[model samples]
Target: MTEIYYVEDDGDIGEAVKEYFESRTFKVTLYRTAEAAKESLRKQLPDLVLLDWNLPDEEGSLLCQWIRSRWKELPLMFLTVRNDTKDIVKGFQNGADDYVEKPFELEVLYSRICALLRRAGNPSGQKVISCGTLTINKEKMMVFCDGQEVSVSRLEYQLLLILMEHKGITVTRQSLLELIWDQNGNFVNDNTLTVAMRRLRQKLNQPSCIKTIRSFGYRMEDEI
Candidate 1:
């Protein structure tokens, strides 16, 4: 299923869009603010984002810039009431794949979304994620380090994938738990994360790649 992150402050519009997408079998997560949406994006990259120009907390253009800096190829579309020519140009300038004005037909919006997804190709997780000598193949759920395949448990692979997906960014412990454990109904303690990190690093034989952020969490450095 294609995952979509929709950010819109208007409750009615957000709900309508969410329902419409969900009805079509697309997994949709709706956020009312750019901050919440950004937090989610940090943990996992959705297939596409349907952003609003006027978010409650920050301008959608700012969010666009932030997302482009981190996930350059992730598709983004502005679903807003701002239909001015400058606004449309600004949306593209900030890395938007498409722009749809408010009061749009659901059918038209769906078509645009399909076109954007087609242009963006497949979701990131379906492709190999690599940094330096480490490579992760999500299709086969395998990791290779320094040209040798490394054995990793399911949880370890999940942890590594998340870190690699958000390389160079500090991934908080809370976010890691929520993304890797809570979803699977696994009751993992903080120590489990530590253990997993230790084992993953040892297996990969690159201890310096994953750095402990003291009280914060962990960050996967781009260069190992």
Candidate 2:
């Protein structure tokens, strides 16, 4: 199932959106405060996050920044009353993938959500991805090297999936940070990528599976 973490302070609005999304077969977890939402994010990364501009404890923008710093690939959208052009721009700057004005049509919201998921390459549930000797089962969130099951962190799995999706192409460091880390490459230290790559390679037991394109980025070979 597609999981959504929705943060809204208003009880009526939160309940209504949660109920509607649940009806559409989405697993919705609603939070009335930014702190609670942040806590949930740390436990498990959701497919998408629907955030309100104003939370009872903190501004949604702050929460967005925190999330981006951690789960960079997670899709986030703003569903709030802040329709001002400045506010929209700020939302995007803060890390929102989409912004919707208040009193939105449920159909429109659903469409936007689907579009975002599609763009993120998670259009549906239970996807199996394979590259070289590695296989990833999305629903199970598990990885296998050859026929042996391998344990990997959530970030490692996300990084591997991105590389596998674009196998053979040198994914630039900046691109990796934007797509995998949700941070500007300039702001994040390159060592972060290095450590993650090292761990992933070790877990897969195939160091040659991922190649560093010296001064550029990394590439996943078609065969290990």
Candidate 3:
């Protein structure tokens, strides 16, 4: 059965949702604290994560960002009482696949869960991608270069995948931020992108792998 890590602090709501998911044949694991959820995650990642907006220890959005940094393809959804547009945008910026306000109908929630799981199972639907002499499995979230496995932070991998998807074309900073950063069209500082690119180049360790465009954006350097 497909597994989901459901992170919510409220006992009543969590139990109700867990039962709802169970009735639909989904294997559900409940987590009440961010630390506990994160600790369990280190052992093995879940197929999808259902996060709440408010946690006893940390905000749900923060946990979502943490998860995105570690595994980009892992499906994430925010099921919380936070109904504001800002909260919704924050969830997206932090790598959430979808957001549903609390007090949602059980049927609607179930439908959303099914849709997310279905999408996760489809590899062809991925928005960002990467490929090279090195093996970069976007779906599996793994990277291999120079006959050795390379460890990549989630953000770096996300950025590399985005650039690789466009390959020869230039991708702008605004585009990268909108796509990669959990920010919703919010201006991202240059340092964040710079650091991610520098790390990506280091992980690939290819001097001319990524070329910076002067006025517009960046592109992968031509390979012979």
Candidate 2 residues lying further than 4 Å off, grouped into runs, are 123-224
**After superposition, candidate 1 runs with Cα above 4 Å error:** 128-224
Clashes in candidate 3: how many?
2
User: Looking at candidate 1, what is the lDDT of residue 136?
Assistant: 75
Which of 1 and 2 is ahead in TM-score? 1
lDDT (CA) for every model shown? 0.83, 0.79, 0.76
For 1-224, candidate 2 gives per-residue lDDT tens digits of: 89898999998988888888899999988899998886655434567899999998999988888877654556899999999999999999999999999998888999999999999787223465556556666766777665457888767887888887787799998788778656223344578877888898887786466788999998887541
Off by over 4 Å in 3: 122-224
lDDT of 1 at 85: 98
Q: What local lDDT score does residue 40 receive in model 3, on the 0 to 100 scale?
A: 63
- The residue-by-residue lDDT of candidate 3 on 129-211, one tens digit each, is 33434445565677755335689987877777777777778899878877875633445567888887888887788646578
* Model 3 Cα shift for residue 175 (angstroms): 49
Least accurate 10 contiguous residues by lDDT in model 2: 180-189
